[model samples]
Target: MYQASKQRYETMPYRHVGQSGLRLPAISLGLWHNFGDVDRLSNQKEILCGAFDRGVTHFDLANNYGPPAGSAERNFGRILREELGQYRDELVISSKAGYYMWPGPYGEWGSKKNIIASCDQSLQRMGLDYVDIFYHHRPDPDTPIEETAGALDLLVRQGKALYIGVSNYSAEQTVAIAKVFKKLGTPFIIHQPRYNMFDRWIEDGLTDVLTQENLGAITFSPLAQGLLTNRYLNGIPADSRAGRSSSPFLSPENVEATINKVQQLNQIAQNRGQSLAEMALAWNLRQPTVTSVLVGASRLSQLEDSLKALNHLDFAAEELAQIDAIVGK
Candidate 1:
């Protein structure tokens, strides 16, 4: 039996979700890459257990996260039943649905049909009565915003989800949908966006609206898919995600210019006695609107190393200037 340490909560700080009563850990785990169908189930379970042991109670997932789609949830469902069943209430399990999922229509986007069906399919896969937080995977251009918001409202009223969130939405879209949620009395709790040292699109306008609306923001890819880490300082190793994986988001072309920027950031991190990955995560958490920094690690040690960012978050003015020079606005 796996026994979680009672002291786990004391080591990592929790931030309240935008004006809500729910609090999320400073660092959350994402099952986007590693936890999939082709991977070893035991290894995935080990990583999940290790994260919980170290105070990562929030695990982010999506309906289309796996290579086969829904495999991540199926795998996590096994863990929930076999290992995490006793600690269900203490964990924050979240799933999203907006991207391409199943074949044919009604499988993607934020329509009422897609949202309701996706949540039902997610609940079935996870073998849970309800998820703590459910999110619209992305905004729909064709679907009416009110319909999408209504689906989320229905989920909460039906006891399928405790809270609702949206991902990859611009400030205007968020504000518009938030109004519908407010009118319907549904809790628009959080917004997930791609944010990191190299990417600040949310800061362009989304952060301001989220602050005003009192909605928490939890950013994904806080390390820029490992570009913010020391793994790419010299050259991409064969096992590195950027080297081995064929993700368009982290292609070799993208790394060409980023190599120098990463090295310079590493120097600043070294001066602060932290790793580049640590600083990257800390940078996101430094934002008051940021509720959690969602991270994914291929190994347990990487997760452990990433958590060290919590030890020293204060940055000197010169250090910030140095970072700005490398990643100027």
Candidate 2:
């Protein structure tokens, strides 16, 4: 009997996905890091429930999000059933395929077999009849774009997914698949790419094409795996992700290489009356094509700190330029 706060929607802002009637919260929760079987269920409940209580209507997931590969969704399914079952319709749940989940040729990528089977597996793990948005986790070099995009469209037709999206796709790849999706009459809406102060590859060409193609984007790694935040300002802590996490995404050398820029950014964030993490989150949302920023938290405090980014999403011309100079953009 956990009652959500009545004011959950009071402070959170929702942005419209590109050219679509659907909207997502400005800051959505991502289950990429925590929420696996190795993590505590009670803590997971606290974070998920806490997010919903504060109006994080979107929760991003993928088939390979867990250490054991499907555990995140399985744990999420339990949370949904035991804690938030009554509020299902109030949430925007999304999952992705295209990553290696099981052995064999059909275990990964964007082939129709992989896509459809992965979706069914994901749905079964999460105990859901349908997901609001389903994505191809990444582009497949060998698989034909038409086959991948067509499989996604088929999901919508089969009532397994509502909208379609693609992640980790370069600008050209996005355009190619988008063209096929248009012809198939798919409700292709969003792109999930890595964007942050330390990583601005999206600005290279993706943002422009997102506008041209009328697709929204939800940026992941917006904190640069916690680099943009104050977490590394004093050097990497022993308990931080870079310190000991099995995830090879971030390393100690990576933190050391970027500490100077991070410190400089922190000073600028302090000047703006916001933390570095807040400014980083706001920076991603600065793009009109960006509909939301996907963030992850291992603790309630971290999640709370991230949510405060909404308090000041605006940045001045000088502030933006200073950030660009610091991060070498």
Misplaced by over 4 Å in model 1 are none
Give the whole-model CA lDDT for all candidates, comma-separated: 0.90, 0.93
Candidate 2: residue pairs that collide: none
Residue by residue across 88-184, what tens digits does model 1's lDDT show?
9999999998999988888899899999999999999999999999999889999999999999999999999999999999999999999999899
Instruction: Tell me each candidate's TM-score.
Output: 0.97, 0.97
Candidate 2 per-residue lDDT, tens place, 1-329, comes to 87899999999999999989999999999999789989999999999999999999999999998767999999999999999989999999999999899999999998999999999999999999999999999999999899999899999999999999999999999999989998999999999998888888988999999999999999999988789888899898998989986858889999999999999999999999999999899988898899999999989889999999999998899999998899888
- The total number of steric clashes, by the backbone 3 Å criterion, in model 2 comes to 0
Q: Pick the candidate with the highest lDDT.
A: 2
Error of model 1, residue 26, in angstroms: 0.1
